[model samples]
Target: MRVALGDFLELNLRVRSADDARLQTIFGFWPAFLVAFALRLVGLFKFPFLDEEDRMMRVAVNGLFGYGPQSGQAPFWENLLFRTPLSNSQAITPLWWWTEYVARLVVKDETLSARLPALLTGLIGLALFYWLARQLFPFPIPALLAWLLAVHDVFLWVGTKAQYVESFIFALSVLIAWALLVAQGKWRPFVVAVLASTTAMGFFLLKGMTLTFNALAVGVAQTALLRGGGRRLNFETIVQRAIFAGLIVTPLAVWLLAAQAYITAHYQVRVAELGYFRGIADILYALTFGYGTGRTASLV
Candidate 1:
């Protein structure tokens, strides 16, 4: 088959296109993507207020309410709760808080403000997932992955109208995934450092360290590849990692200190008798065995 190179290239592209079309057909691809995004917006104004969504709203508008009267209550009970020396705490990630904070300024309802960012971010995640899949995998397969995720029941429910912290968490996750995929290629270590650092900072601001911890794990993997067993990491690479780590933690540390101080000044004294580690364990149990965002005594 003495075919011309041009013809071979054209044939390869056509085969790829056909494969993508077939996968989309089997998966209900575009209809599902469009429908999923639309469905997320359906009854946007009518979706009622959920429980913890209000507490997060408080974190934004009311400042840190750690060690308040919510003790023996639900926010600490239902979801994975982080404790930092407080009897009753409400120190959620600043990202969603501030987001809902600003959203409150515009949309004057509890449910809409809290869920607005979630809805927007979830849709962004959907589009970005497709791009990320293309970056991480070859055609048709990437297309398939995006379409499957579009209609995924649990993920779609959480990311879209659930209005949980998982919304923006999911959004930032896609950004982090994109950054990770690009970092695998020609991006300089410093570029990856910036991408990762900023993403982790924003992620920390929105949620607690759970996803931040995942980001750290990914950074470690990338560092291993960057080292490539060729030689020990140089001083500059060390510095890059150092700066990256600093960018990730410093904001959180400052936020915690200031938030803690402010809460102590404004609210009743926070008691640490309940134990911070205990709170972490309780939350772990709730997430693992209990509902994704509600309190349960599954292990406690």
Candidate 2:
């Protein structure tokens, strides 16, 4: 009877402890989020021309308005895949470009629209970072880390600018957090692997090559380190890890193929219009043609 009573009491205490921790996490997140939002909000509207926001806004504008003489000739898929903004090499990530274009469509303000994605990802990253920290550390540490990240100048700068850094970091945070959870066995490995791989791929579409390699490295390193600590990784776990590594690489390969096809089609259109042979002959023709016509002879 005494043993039964002690066991019941211990269980009750643990339940209450978990409830308190849950409440603390809930409370910590809102305050940190609000404060971070307030800090980042001003930068969104105030310094709109910082970094590559100008260049990205131009790309987004071209994405909405179409690019080059072949702009109208492009199929829906061509427009969807190629956002190089009048050239083949200047392509921003398709997802980010679309985000900017859609926001511009609704908001009708170029700078604000371009910066919105970064601001949103910044907030989302804060939430993910806080959750990950809470899972890995004690109460005050998670809360403190959340506040610190929220106030960090670099995070603040990138989070409010119109560029890929904030989104890339946000994607990286998601990958690392998911990896850690899988390592801790808090979730089913297969489900987590699929979801994390998909998330990595999706973000790779948004930010391109950087996220792919980072996701692969994080998966291998986190799983290996955790598995090294006396717990033998099963065959299924190995297969899941392999699946994740493969999935992450798969997106990059597919994207490169699509990008190459789009660029080739786009340049073909440019060449037919500009009357050049092939392989950057258009660029050479432009320089020489200008000089031959005496348009650029004054500079010489």
The candidate scoring highest on TM-score is: 2
TM-score on alpha carbons, each prediction: 0.64, 0.68
lDDT of 1: 0.54
RMSD of each: 7.5, 8.8
What C-alpha lDDT values do all the predictions have? Answer: 0.54, 0.60
Model 2 steric clash pairs? none
Candidate 1 Cα outliers beyond 4 Å, as residue runs: 1-30, 54-91, 160-163, 185-208, 225-232, 244-249, 263-300
Candidate 1 lDDT by residue in tens digits, 140-189: 67667776777777666666453355555566667666666565433364
Candidate 2, residue 266: how far the Cα is off, in Å: 6.8
Error of 2 at 196 (Å): 4.8
> In model 1, what are the clashing residue pairs, if there are any?
67-88, 77-295, 78-294, 78-295, 94-205, 95-205, 95-206
Task: For candidate 1, report its TM-score.
Answer: 0.64
